[model samples]
Target chain A: MQKIILNQTWKGMLMEVKRSSRTKTAVSVVVPFILLAVMIGYVFGPGSELISFGVVIPEISIEKVEFVDSEIIATVRNTGPIAVDIVMADINDRIYPAAIEPDKHLERFESAIVRIPFEWNEGEPYAVGLTIDDGTRFEKQVDVAAPSIQPTVEMITYFAIIGTYVGIIPVMIGLLWFPFISKLSRSKYKFFLALTVGLLLFLGISAAEEAIEISSENLSDVFNGVLLVATVAIVSFLALNFVGEKLKKRAGASKLAGPIAIALMIAIGIGLHNFGEGLAIGAAIVLGEAALGAFLIVGFALHNTTEGFAIAAPMARTKLMIGRLAAMGMIAGVPAIFGAWVGGFVYSPLAAVIFLAIGAGAIFQVIVTIMRWIQNEEGKLSNSSVLAGIAIGMIIMYITSILV
Target chain B: MLTGGQKMIIVITVVSLGFAGYLVFPAMDITAQEQPEVFVTHSGAVVQTTGDVLDPVYTIQEVEFDPEKYLREFDYGEVSQLEDGTTLREFTIIAEDDKIMEIAPGIFYNVWTFNGQVPGPTIRATEGDLVRIHFTNNGDKEHTIHFHGNHPAEMDGIFEIVGSNGGQFTYEFIAGPVGVHPYHCHVMPVEEHIGHGLYGVFIVDPKDARQQADEMVMMLNGFDTDFDGENNLYAANTIPYYYQHHPIQINTNELIRVYVVNMVGLDPINNFHLHGTLYKYYPTGTDMVPSEFTDMTTFSQSERGILEFEYEYTGRYMFHAHLTEFSEKGWSGVFYAKDNSQPNMEGYAYGS
Candidate 1:
């Protein structure tokens, strides 16, 4: 009687397992499209709705002037958007023929340095004035300055060119490439678990370090205090938990959800980051940094693609409707859009920091989730291949550092 | 530790080296080197009126530059038209200590008075070199006399400056481009003084700008009027007005150069409209040809340019301010083109 009962129990358990494993046809068809639509909206949504009729103009009063190599470099920037269009230049009553453009120097908020390269005769102080020609006419003295020695070429070019690529592309491609191959196939669940772990580790270490560093720099032990640390940790965990649940729900049961989540989150993060990145690129282009921007594009593209795949795979199981799937895909892809917008608009490091934090958080969560899932599936020791891949990733990252 | 003498020697060496390095290989940029220099310049504001006949209350009589030598070498003349079907009249102006010998108190500030104001009585000239006027500003701040006409570079007031608190400068040039341009203070806080009525009209007579019957000088200037058009501040002093539009009126064949200068220290991308006609851009005081030049006209901030176009039909086209916000805050006006051939450049010069 005992043996019969045991057999019956085993049979029931196996039937349940088999029933659960069957992919729901309805879900497969509908969920993907839904997710895709959501992804798309998130990506190409609204940008800078915060500002209406936004027009930035930069005006400058020549603070100091120097003449170098027949070029006039003016250190001019003040409070207000610099919008003064340099009109004309005159020396002792003769029209001085020369070119006027922005100086190839980094400008901080409320301050900027512009270089107006012009043919110089090297004599009396030239009375330089620019006639702003937008809708108004503003004239200011152009303090001439000697041209600055060209910055270290290699260092600048490398960073300007390769920094962007490293920032976006490689990571994306790596993540995406993991699932498509047969032998290299990584289950969506496993990958997300691992990704979540990685992202968490990075964020935890980074945020902690950053907070501690800030405190130390100010000679304060308050941040390192148990209470503060605990608070931050708890807050971070709770936020992460909430976000994680939302992401999971969004992913649904379609194995694709894992990758889709990863992609969508990263893409959004990238979109935010790209805005600032775009500014850098635009500035670079203006300053003759085309090669650098190109290189960056490659890196960003690769990194973003991998990220997309990672986001898409986990949610793959649901087989959501095309619209939802497209939405998810777009959401995953949004980082690029956001990045591009920001890169074109606000050019600041503060922007960079905010994006970095968000990205670090999402990446951490995804990595951890992916890892756990993978470990469960393998039913063996934690995968060494992943470790190896991570190492490789690190090495690649280190190589890019060469450009920086 | 080194002895006191050794330390002193080291310190001295470092200091000397640092100073020397400042001259040779300066550390990026040396701020100390940006000291404001002492130079003669013409900088001040003046208000004036316009008419064919001079208003005895504001007629410019004498003109001189403090640093007389600069004046002797430079060109100085007014943009005016002669009565004999000619354009522009040549005259000399002296800007003395921000006060062109105060016009017996009333309402006057500039060198020559036009209808009793400093902007040297709005002078009406034509496209070609009709009249050349010389000006000298003896004011506290730097100033320039820009002629929105076909003026020569020597006469272009851009290089002229009146010293600070106690300085004088000379401006000389020929009027070529025909357009009604606003002449006012281009300094940092010029809007304050100008809003206090320190500006005038520089009428550059276009070949077709002659209207015998109903002619007027429309000057369109603005200040950040806070409460019911009251107090006005200059650039940096006045708060930014997100929405405000100022407009100027002009008739068909009438040349009007909206001398828009943002001395308000704010970012205003204003759009100039001509109701029905597509405004053709003309030369400002910056770039003017000797005989007749009109091609290479690149607009700049705080610069001047002529918007020329004739209306097909005689109608009061609403030339309202395009900037919606600027318009809402009393920054708007109308272009009542009464006649098809009536050259109307009246009221306050619409100097942006």
Candidate 2:
């Protein structure tokens, strides 16, 4: 009876093992089909309803309203994250046909001019409303309708005067320090050269930062704006270096020629920087952010005065004619006038970024040249007086920049 | 008592060993690990991947896109006989730019699409057929459809700018050259338009159809999420790693014809590699004869070709971009070739 019972137990265990193996095989096949079915269901089923609500956020800012002849022209900008489409326009609560220049589509930060042919009485209150594609409306009111001021010769003269005050005069005043600097001892002269390096370094860094910020914020992504800035800066640096090397090679024989070349380079670098600053000021004035007040002019003049000193430091030992000094000052200042005209009339973010990048690159190249010169003069880079002068120079620029 | 050179060698050896240890130990530990724990939601539900759920602020809620459905889908358009007795295929494409989609796991991107989908629709036509596209730009930005084929100068999408917000333009052209081409937005800064998903496959068939086979459209693409002029995600379709997770099913010994179009912008070139088999490549499908029999092919932007092959055995086969960086980022997939004798578990009678 015991043998029979053990035989039955062994048979039962074998059967159980076979059954478990079959189940495992079945599971392996079924699991894949189950997952496939789930995936199909998830893909085609109504459970995955992608109905977006409250996602469309439309915003538009009416920057300016002007009356030209019988037409009411309004400049509008897309201020929201998404692009905005202006479909219809209304003036004084009545729908009117309007023409939008450069199409009705205003991409983010893109501005368009809406022209409406309407004869409006002077000094009358009117509400201008714009309707986007989604029927969201944006309205701006004009208390009194008046003819907009077109840019005139008087305006041109005014901008030129501002440029002179901010760019030319301050730099000329700082250039007067050349006579005093030429009398300094040789050791002090080395310190001033180091100081010039510090000033240029600060300027380069600030210009590069501004370029990056503007490109990232205002420029279109299609332009690869930040990359454009970086590329232009790198190219500018290499190109300036190449040119400087050529100049140095040509001026190899004379000790005086080296200082003149360095001084010219410094002026060019400072000129480019001033041009970018002028662009900012001009754009601000055109955008109605800056008033025709003395604060901005005074601040900019004080800030730009240090650039002249940087130029003069390189040419302190060299005897410069008054005509040459005047020409150098003009080279360091005249680009600002052109920059202001461009910025006020046809300001482009791409141009701003490129100009700033070029300025930064030029300044960086100047710094490198100054450092190499200092090493040549003093035999080593880590002099105590040089370090202190550099610190002081940077601090002075920083303080002046705060006012601007 | 050591010389300077000897001391330097010792220091170098010690630093390298430490560096190697830093890299190798964690990798070894990872290899020893089994299945990862399933991420549980706050409400006690098990999530398959961490990216299954995401914040809805930047991301649109549950974008309706199935890469599998798109793989085999084609838009043949409404066919009609013209006055001259030629075939006319009319299609209407609506462009939109206001949708944010989850391109990868938890990575949301603002994709500008044609007909509400990336890579748009695969437009198919005969070589001599007149294709008329009633293109409408409902998006807030300017867009245009430029076809990469022989056409009249006026028919070119450039020069003639289309305004946005209900702007309409009809592109009428005779499909020619008998090849697979790419149609994309030809607006200024074309890279941005293409990169943001404004491209599609255009297949112009020969007068006589080729051998009957399972045909598919594969548009290799990438996305620049950060807009830094470099693509962060790469894929055969819009979603990254989608094909890898859900392998494409195919029948063994069946001819597979794949029309591969590389629409990735920013990157200069992209490539494809098939594992376990070589394919008969027809460069652009312009000629009747096969150009080469190879397992890999490279393509510049907008370059496309025809890849014809058949699987001999039933198993899973891998296919991916030959460039390792692309494959690692998500431009890889698997083809599951099943034997005909197996049970029809897919529920569909048609072969892939």
Residue A121's C-alpha lDDT in candidate 1? 59
Superposed by TM-score, candidate 1 places the C-alpha of residue A218 at a distance from the truth, in angstroms, of 20
Cα-based lDDT at residue A226, candidate 1 = 35
- Number of the top candidate by DockQ? 1
lDDT of 1 by residue, B227-308 (tens): 2232121211111110111113435555443333222213333334446666445444333333233322222333445444
Off by over 4 Å in 2: A1-404, B1-36, B39-63, B343-352
lDDT of 2 by residue, A8-49 (tens): 998888688888878888899999999999987887577665
User: In candidate 1 chain A, what residue range of length 10 has the lowest lDDT sum?
Assistant: A101-110
lDDT of 2 by residue, B129-192 (tens): 9999999999999999998898988778897767888899999999988989999999978888
Give candidate 2's total backbone clashes. 0
TM-score for each of the candidates: 0.29, 0.41
**In each prediction, how many residue pairs overlap at the backbone (N, C-alpha, C within less than 3 A)?**
220, 0
**Number of the top-ranking candidate, with lDDT as the measure:** 2
Two-chain complex of model 2, DockQ on C-alpha atoms against the true structure: 0.01
